[model samples]
Target: MILGIITDCTHYTSPSGEVCTENHILLRQFKHLSAYFEKTIILCPFGKFDDRKVTTTYTSSNIQFHQLPLVGGNAMKDKVQLLVTVPKWLRAFKMLHRQCDVVYQRFPNNLNIPGFIYFWLQRKKVFATYTGTWSGYQGEAASYRLQRWILRSPFRGPVWVYDEKGKEQGRIRNGFSPSYSVAEWEEETAQVEKRKQRIENGLTTYKFLTVGTIIDYKNQLAIVQACHVLKQKGFSFQLTIVGDGPMKAELEEYVIKNGLQEEVKLVGKQNHVSLRQLYREHDFVVQAPLKEGFGKVPIEGFFHGVIPVINNISMASQMIGANERGFLFDASKPNHLVETLLSLPAQQHLFAGMINKGRTYAKLQTLEAWAREYYETVSAYYNEA
Candidate 1:
């Protein structure tokens, strides 16, 4: 069966960790306005490569969605651009509808009018995986209400959410019998598997790492404050903040003010390989996000057998599960974070145990496994109809 996956700008990468090529017949849908819901996908841009038509059978193995830009021009920027793009997008959707069997969408809501019409008209099955309520991003309460109304429409299909709470809401709010899915990571044992070049425990200090971009939403400042508390209380752990963002300079100042200059280091942005290796050197991982939609860093850390100290939020609560693999602090209460870390009985040893448990959990959900699940569900829905 030919399977077509439709998603927005966010879910960009493939399971194999390669940039999707235009020869892959990937189409990018563009949103018309922040207020209006019309969205359409035209042919992706190519440097020198030409657009390739999709086929039902995978016989044309040389085809790919190569060198296509992930985002079209901002929908609100120019009305002319939006008007011109919609027709091309409609044509692309019509082509895929005739060529492919199933279309899997990972968008959280029915905010794309063109996509909505195409999928609705094609009579092809639609499978969606949602993260959470878009209330925070919708600007105002009325905006969120409007979105909720759209989300509850009957035309949508069986949906999947990251957590049970979200899953339950999906059924009530979206007419979806939601399923739960986990992020996929490589399997690892409690101990780091030694390779050709292994670094001995030569560093005499405990190192902590926090992955993900440095932003206000991530609450890295809270981590720095916790480090200050640890310092005042005589705990001497070194922190390495990975990834870069607008909050870097402010966060650096906070680190300095708290007298943690010697302890905390902002390493800026590192690619996945560097971050993975950095995970090996660190004693644990920490995320202090104000809220999260499935924090993948903890799972990544878990794969590397690094104990993850996560904030107690929806995703973290679901992921950590009664503190089986890590510590969860009440994010509402900032002081609680400091107290929790300070109170750990033999912190390193407790962390090691958590790492083992977390690693085991991370192993089960492979990306290939997730893709297979998504594909099968879409296939069944299309065939049954």
Candidate 2:
């Protein structure tokens, strides 16, 4: 059967005849989906093809790319452009719907709205996976709210959300999982064992790692402040901030001004492979995001037996199994994270058990396992008719 995927993700072609993406995870998902379906059509906005900037490696013979006009943007001019261009894309989506046996759409995307409406109008079999926080949190874009409303409508088919709480709202489980292979897991496990030995012998300094784009929404500044509190309280720990964004410069300035240049380091962005190596050396993965959608970094950290210390938000708390699998802090309380960090060394011995439980949980949610779940869900719905 032909599987059509409607998304807002950009697709680019390299000058050397290679299909590439800036998002390695998305590229991996596409490759996995291609393996599951006989013919997979990726419908997305086509960006400028440049070999020089291409970073992600992904190419599949069974996968076909269908570029459409760029649909959503934040500016007023972009909205006007979308108004003038949507009709043309609507016709393209209708044609795509006619060729597909079933349609799968990524939610919280304005570009997917026209395609979703077209599928509904034609009574096509379609399912969606929501990629944002399912807690109905405020500050979400209007387009995202509209998309959620449409998916929750009775007329819509099965909708998958990343949080367990979403099940109460009629959303299915779309759990976040890591993409680590068995070999990688074994290697990371060895590193974790070595680190545990060092912790036991008092030969290691506590290492904290946070992986995500540096943005206001991610609340990296909160992590810095929390670390400052820990330092003032006489805690010897190092924080490594991964991923880069607009907030990097400001965060760097704060670090330098507070005499935390040595304690805090902004390492910019690293690929998945590099990140796995970095994860091996860290004791805990700390994140204080104001909002989160599944928070995959924690899951990824778990695979390496690194404990996650995250804010007590809905999706994050649920993913970490409400502190059963990892530690949770209240971002609202300034001293909460600091207290948690300061208390870690005294409780370091208990980390072995926590890491074991977390690793076991992460092992079950690999990319292959998730793909099987996704394929089964889509296949069941397709066979219903």
Candidate 3:
């Protein structure tokens, strides 16, 4: 059987005919699906750019890419361009629906709206994965709310969601799962053990990390401010901010102007391997994002036994489990994070236990297992067809 995937993430084709993407997690998920299906076709926005500098690439002869003329942007001109290209996108989806046996659309993406509607109209075997906040629909964009409404309709097939609260959508079969791999869990365990030993030897400075794009919603500035508060309190800690985006300059200015250069470091984006190393050395993963879908950073941090000290949001509390596996602070108040960090040294004895429990939970959610579940869910629909 052939599988077709629709997503907003960009896919790049190297001169050597290799599929490359900046999203390593998506690439890995595609690779896992490739093993189960006879062939897989990824339908995403494509651009003709040199991918030689890109570190992550997926090279599989069985996997083919069907690039769509879907130039995505939020600007007014880009919106007009998208409207003009709607007819072309619909035609492409109709063709894709006929060619593939199963179609999987990643939700919360406007690019897939046309494809999803066409596939539903054709009565095709379609499944979806919603990797967004599933708690309350309030404050979300109208398009996002519309997508959620479509997924919840009785017409949609089995849907897998990252948040357990998504099960409330009783009209559709919603499954909850974490995105991780066995190799990742094993590496995290090793790192956690090494860090545990170092902590036992009495390390001086506590290392805290936050991984995500430097966006306003991500609230990297709040993290920096909290670090500043900690520094004022004479706490010996270092906060390393990873990932890059438009707000990099603004964040740098905040760090420099606040005289927090030594307390906070913006390491920019790093490859998967480099990130794994950082997770190993860091003592805690601190994030106060305004919103999150699945909170993959916390999961990745949990695997490495890096206790997640995150904001008290739906995704964070759900992933970390009521502060048992990790700590949670109020995102609305920056001082809450500072207070959480200050209490860490006093609770140092509880670190090993939390790490062990987190690793145990992460072990159960492997990519292999997720693929198996996905295959079963899709095969049921195929059988019905």
How many clashing residue pairs appear in each of the predictions shown? 12, 0, 0
lDDT per model vs. reference? 0.57, 0.79, 0.79
Decreasing TM-score order of the candidates: 3, 2, 1
TM-score of each: 0.72, 0.92, 0.93
* TM-score of decoy 3: 0.93
Q: By summed lDDT, which 10 consecutive residues of candidate 1 come out lowest?
A: 28-37
Q: Give me the overall lDDT of model 3.
A: 0.79
lDDT string for model 1 (154-249, tens) is: 546656555525445533322122111232143333245441012232324556798777888899988888888888988768899987789999
Instruction: Report the Cα lDDT for candidate 1.
Output: 0.57
Of 1 and 2, which scores higher on lDDT?
A: 2
Worst 10 residues of 3 by lDDT: 168-177
Candidates 2 and 3 compared by TM-score, better number: 3
Off by over 4 Å in 1: 10-63, 66-84, 109-113, 133-152, 164-187, 193-204, 257-259, 345-349
| Candidate 2 residue-wise lDDT, 148-239, digit = tens | 77877843666777664645444455556446655666667777777667676763478999998899989999999888887887888999
Native-referenced Cα lDDT, model 2 = 0.79
In candidate 2, how many clashes are counted?
0
Better of 1 and 3 by lDDT: 3
